[model samples]
Target: MKDIAIVAYQQSDGVSDAGAVNEVELIMPVLDRTFEQARLDSAQDVDFVCSGSCDYLQGAAFAFVAGVDALGAVPPIKESHVEMDAAWALYESILKIRMGHADSALIYGFGKSSPGELPIVLSQQLDPYYLAPQWVDSISLAAMQARLMLDQGLITERDMAEVVSRSRRNARSNPHAQLAGDVSPEDVLAQETYLSPLRKADCCPVSDGASAVVIATVEKAKEWGLPYAIISGIDHRIETHNLGMRDLTDSVSTRTAAEHAGMHDGKVDVAELYAPFSHQEIILTRALGLGEETSINPSGGVLAGNLMMASGLSRIGEVFNRIVSGEAQRGVAHTTSGPCLQHNLVTVLEKA
Candidate 1:
């Protein structure tokens, strides 16, 4: 693969509800900031443009076409869209660059999941005959996964609460985070359970937001004279759909994806994992073999605020932020989709 570098990343504030903020409005400011940072005038300046969003969130088909309004329609631009998280959209853009189709690309993802029952809406994405028909919400599926972990002595309730506590505390430094404060494990355990074996604190709060990233070849970055981070390696993997067949306690898919992404090539100074649920963070951390040497979710991750389609991209963006700011020499970012982390993507970033 051709060496590529991320030039810029920007995101909107994570809020529980965006109220009357239309999709275009929510995305415009983020695009402007990203463009400014990348020294580009508009999406037209990039060789290709791709977005990540879900039509289901708006209850209409081809809803992402409206996002074009934010991108400017008069000038023709090469563009595409993906139904999955924007992190996957970044994956697509990376392939486009490596294939020599383009030297630079703009990628973005947006979501407004507060308008409907997010859990129920996501349930439709599950196996139609076996799971979707039953209308099992996302929380319930995760709760079952948590139960399996608990039954096997993999983690304790206190362990889960500790994850939440760290997330909340870590989010304090994130200006865009929705849930950030000092809360201890005892405080988390005191809260009543929203679902069996899973407290509300253990779940990510629904959020409406958008995030954008710009990438180019290393030569392009040097020509632009902007500090950047190199994308060392990336890979994605998925497990069997049948929940009963897989080991819920371990993230086999994450481990496989990490190995393929060259995560063990060197020391990982920081990691931004897209773990919507607290326990899943522990699962990913252990799966990646991260220790005290690595900082996990220093920006509080999705648990601070969950933007359905965009959080995955935000994870990668977070790592880029750390690297450019000199907080980390190399970092790993992880993203997930489906119930109980059924599908996973891992990305490795390094200082240039």
Candidate 2:
């Protein structure tokens, strides 16, 4: 496979609620900035475009189609859309780049969860016939996962609080994070629970956000003088859709994706993992074989603020940020979709 690299990335500041800004107004500038940072003109340098987003967020079908207009499609750019997160779309774009069908590509993901009841909408992602009717919200599902982890002795309630404290504390330095501050595991534990074992602090706040990345082949990266990070390997896998059919304490899909992406080959310099809940991060860290030496979610990660479809892509953009800023030579970013880690994607990146 041809080597593909992320050449540019940009993200909008995540907010608790992005008022009345339409998706186009919110994303157009980000798209423009990403292409500019890549040192490429959108209409000239880009060969294909792929996006990750969901219709449920907007309460309308084809919500992603309008976001595509942010690319200024009068010239008719090659494009596709995924009902999943933008990282999955990025994965598709990478496949195209590897095929020699395109040298450079752009990918974007957007989510605005503020206008309506966020959790209610996410419940629809479950099986329509069996799960949707139950209306199990995202936080409760995460709480279930947390309870299982607790039962397995993989983590404790105190550990969950610590994860929340650390993630939000790290967000203080991140200008784009929606939640950031210092709190104690004891303080978090003392808070009221939204669901037993899951407090408000443990749950990611609903957010409005968007993010994008520009990727190019090795030859094209040299041509544009773009800061590049090699796409060493990319892979994703799916697990049994029914939460009851699988072990809730661990993510098998994440393990498969990491192994397929060759994450265990050598020492990893850094990692950007997309885990909206603190427990999921623990599960992912174990599955990816990431230990104390590996820097995980230096960008504060999704627990600071999860804009649904945008969180996964934002993780990719975070690793690209590290590469371009000369922080490390090698890294990995992982993304997930569906309930309780039903789908997972992993990408290995290196600065050359």
Candidate 3:
């Protein structure tokens, strides 16, 4: 198979409230910056265009149609949309390249989560019969997961607090991060728990933003005369929907996806994991078997600023940035969906 590489990537500032700015407005600037980075004029420059988003955030059907407006589909460009996060859209674009459907594709994901109650909006994705009706928000489910981890001796409160502390410290250098500062675990522990066994700092802040990435065959990347990072392997796995039946303390699906993604084939110098909760970060690190050699969440991960549908793709973008900037030789990026990290997508990126 011909190697597909990311040639350019760009993202908007993650804000708590992007008041009145529609999805199209949020995506346009990101697309423009990505085009400028890849030296393309517009969406027409790519063989295909795809996107990821959730209409539930807008409380309207076909809300994603507005995203195409950012493409200026003057001549009717070939495009597609995924109801999931943009990371899945990236997966779809890779399939397009692999199947000879197109040589290059542009992928983007955006979400304006501030307008709605994000936790409640997310609850709708739960099992409709039992969970959704009870209005079990995402945070409560995560809190339950944390409780399981604590009860099973898999992790401690300090361990979770340290994750948040480190995330804030690392995010201090990320201009796009919504929450960044020199915070310590002690500082995090001092705060009152939002949910039993979980402090507000232990959870990711809801953020509104868009992210874009341009990918092409390595041949095309060289032809375009730009720096690139090869996507060596990518795979995703989903757990059964019965949340009660799964092991909340461990992310078995993440491990399965990592194995299929060939993460063991090379040393992971950096790992960009989409862990919305602090304890989940620890769970993912253990599942992937990463150690001191790996730099986890240098971009602060989701605990700094979670972009909902777009954070997954941004994880891949963060790895791409690390490779191109000579920060590392290889890395792994993980994206998740569903309650308690039930689904996972893992990608291995390497220097070109």
Best by lDDT: 3
lDDT of 3 by residue, 97-154 (tens): 9999999999999999988899999999988898899999999999999999999998
Of the candidates numbered 1 and 2, which has the greater lDDT value? 1
Candidate 2 per-residue lDDT over residues 64-86, each given as its tens digit:
87897788787678899888899
Q: In candidate 1, what are the lDDT values of residues 1-352, reduced to their tens digit? A: 6799999999999999999988899899999999999999999889998999999886778878999889975678888899999999999999999999999999999998888999999899888888799999999999999988999999999999999999999999999999999999999999999998999999999999999999999999999999999999999999998888998889999999999999999999999999988899999999999999999999999999988899999999999999999999999999999889999999999999
Clashing pairs in 3: none
Q: After superposition, how far is residue 92 of candidate 1 from its true place, in Å?
A: 0.6
CA RMSD per model (angstroms) = 0.8, 1.2, 0.6
Whole-model Cα lDDT of every candidate shown, in order: 0.94, 0.85, 0.94
lDDT for model 3, please.
Answer: 0.94
Runs in model 1 lying further than 4 Å from the true structure: none
Q: Give the TM-score of candidate 2.
A: 0.97
Q: Taking the candidates one at a time, how many backbone clashes does each contain?
A: 0, 0, 0
What stretches of model 2 exceed 4 Å from their correct place?
none
- Candidate 1 is scored at a TM of 0.99
